[model samples]
Target: MKIRHLRNATALLTLGEHRLLIDPMLARPGSIPGFKFFGGGRRPNPLVPLPPDTFSWLEEVTGVLVTHPHPDHLDTAGIRWIREHGLPVWTSRLDAPGLGKRGLTVHSLEDGALGMGVERIPVRHGRGLLAWLLGRVSSYYLAHPDEPSVYITSDAVLTEDLLEAVERLQPDVIIAPAGSANFGVGGDILFSVDELVTLVRRAPGGVVLNHLEALDHCPTTREGLRERMKAEGLLEKVLIPADGEELHFARPERARGPAAPGPGATQERERASLASGM
Candidate 1:
């Protein structure tokens, strides 16, 4: 599989025959309002523009995968582009109806949607009142038959549920936000640098970190994250790709073991357990 990191959480994920565009936040720099609500360093969002070759890369997108409806994930420009291309959009059950209402072909991302085993792992985007206000977000585990499995922990804070998912799914590649976002008052809305370090150490396979440097609220820099990871002896296991950088991963032989019982049974159980406070 090949992952081309674009600005923020946006990426061109090449999995088998599919070129899935993950979270297209296509907007000119400073087009959106600032996300930092309190302290200093407040500025319009999307601090940087897409790389010069971003359009060329976008042309290959076969579909769109949206983790949430937040403007940063799917902004006006992104929605316009998708409508123009008439691409099918895969989203969670909670978001499908809303997306459909917007006049796009929306499909719920369920098990076996695109010839891949899929699981939806719920994640908290923040904590306390801020988390509730942010609504629900989900991380996805996608296992293609002939490629390495990938778990996308979309914009979230560290949680036991998240750690449990990592332990159970054991994805070959983990894509997570590492910008350590904050509204300047509500603490962190995304993973802190320390949490990211622990996450990298816990993963059994490669980890890809994104959501850095492009936005106003995200304070973690690639250089800083690299430095921290190096200190922890975890740099080799993690990748902090720059915008427009592409990385490829071959499926490990170990990942080719027999299939699990049902497509998303493990995730279902996990979600149920969490719901029951188990």
Candidate 2:
């Protein structure tokens, strides 16, 4: 399996026969409004531009996986690109209808969809009112017969469910958002540095972190994360890639292990969604 770290929260994940583009935040620098809505020092979003090879790399995408529909994850440019490509989008039920409305070819990402060992783990974007406003987010675990198992923990604040998923899934690679985003008024919405330390310590294998130094709300710096990881003796397990830097991991040959089931999590989401009549 190859996980190319394209840019903040965006990745080109190649697993088995799939080249899934994860979270296509393809806007040019300063194209979108700032995200630090309540933050006093808010600046124009996407503090940097897509790396030079982004356009070319985008051509290889076979499908799309949206963890959430926030502008940073699926911006106007990203939406248009996927529409043009007519690629299938694998995502949680929450955002499927919305994305379909935007002309995307949507496929719900329930477990075992597409014949891949899949698990949809629900995540919280923030705590309290901010989380409520952000609504619910999703994390995904994909285990293709030809690649290592991966857990993509979309934008989330640490929660018991998340920790449980990590413990249960035992993913070979974990791709998480490290932006540490926060509207000035709320506490850290994304993972705080301490939380990331804990997350890395607990994960089974490598951790690829992004979503830093791009937007106004996300204050965590890559340098800072590196230092902390180094101090915690976790640098070897962490890959803090630059905008275009890519990391390649060998695909495991043994695909016999049963993937951790997320039926418990899915049932909870279904109940919640049904309760809301969504």
Candidate 3:
């Protein structure tokens, strides 16, 4: 599978026959408002322009994935782009109705919706009242026969449920936001740098970190995250790709373990061991 970081949380996730555009905050530089609501570092979002080759790359997209309806995830520009291309959208069951309300043709992505294995893991946007304002977010674990399984943890704060999902899914790649974003009034709405380190350390396979340097609220730098991960003895398992960079994920070279018994058993057994290890 080829994963291209399009800027912010936006990406083109190419797996098998699908080139799924994930969370498109498509905007011309300086066209949108800034996100830093406190501590005074506000600047127009998407500090850079799309790569010169973006259009050629985007032309391969087969569909879209909307983890949430927030402007940063699925902005007005993103919506218009999808409509112009007439691309199909895969979203959570709850968000689908709302997207449909706005005239977007939607496809609900519940468990097994992909005709391959999949698990929908709902996540909290933040802590306390901040979470309420951030609204509900959905993360997904997709297992495709043609490629390594991947877990896309959309905008979210670290939580027991998320950790549990990570332990269970055992995805070959875990794509999570690593910005540690916060508005002045609230704390981090996504995983803090420390939390991301822990998440990367615990992942069964490779971890790809994104959501950095694109918005004002997310201040965690890739260098800082690397230092922490290296300190934690986990630099090998995690990847921090730059915007417009494309990475290919190959299946792990080692082989072990018997096939998991029955439906969901692979995930269930993995989760069970997580608690035992803790």
lDDT digits (tens) for residues 15-123 of candidate 2:
7778889999998888888877773878887888877767777788889999999999999999999988889998899889998998888999986786788889889
Best by TM-score: 1
| Alpha-carbon deviation at 8 in model 3, angstroms | 0.8
TM-score of each: 0.92, 0.91, 0.89
Model 1, clash count?
A: 0
Candidate 3 stretches greater than 4 Å from native: 252-278
Lowest lDDT block of 10, candidate 1: 263-272
The digit string of per-residue lDDT tens for model 1 on 1-278 reads 88888889999998899999999999999999999988988899889988777877789999999999999999999999999999999999999999998888999998888888899999999999999999999899998887778899999999999999888887878999999999998789999999998898888777899999998899999999999999999988888887777777776654353234111111100111212221
Name the candidate that leads on lDDT.
1
Off by over 4 Å in 1: 255-278
Off by over 4 Å in 2: 253-278
True-vs-predicted CA distance for residue 168, candidate 2, Å: 0.7
User: Candidate 2: deviation at residue 40, Å?
Assistant: 2.3
In order, the Cα lDDT scores of the candidates are: 0.86, 0.82, 0.79
Put down candidate 3 lDDT per residue, 1-278, tens digits, no spaces.
77888788998987777789999888888888988877899998777776666767788888899999998899888899888899889999889999988767799986556565667888988899989887889998877665677889998878888888877667778899999988877788999888887788778877889998888888999898889888999887877877677777654444422111112111101111212221
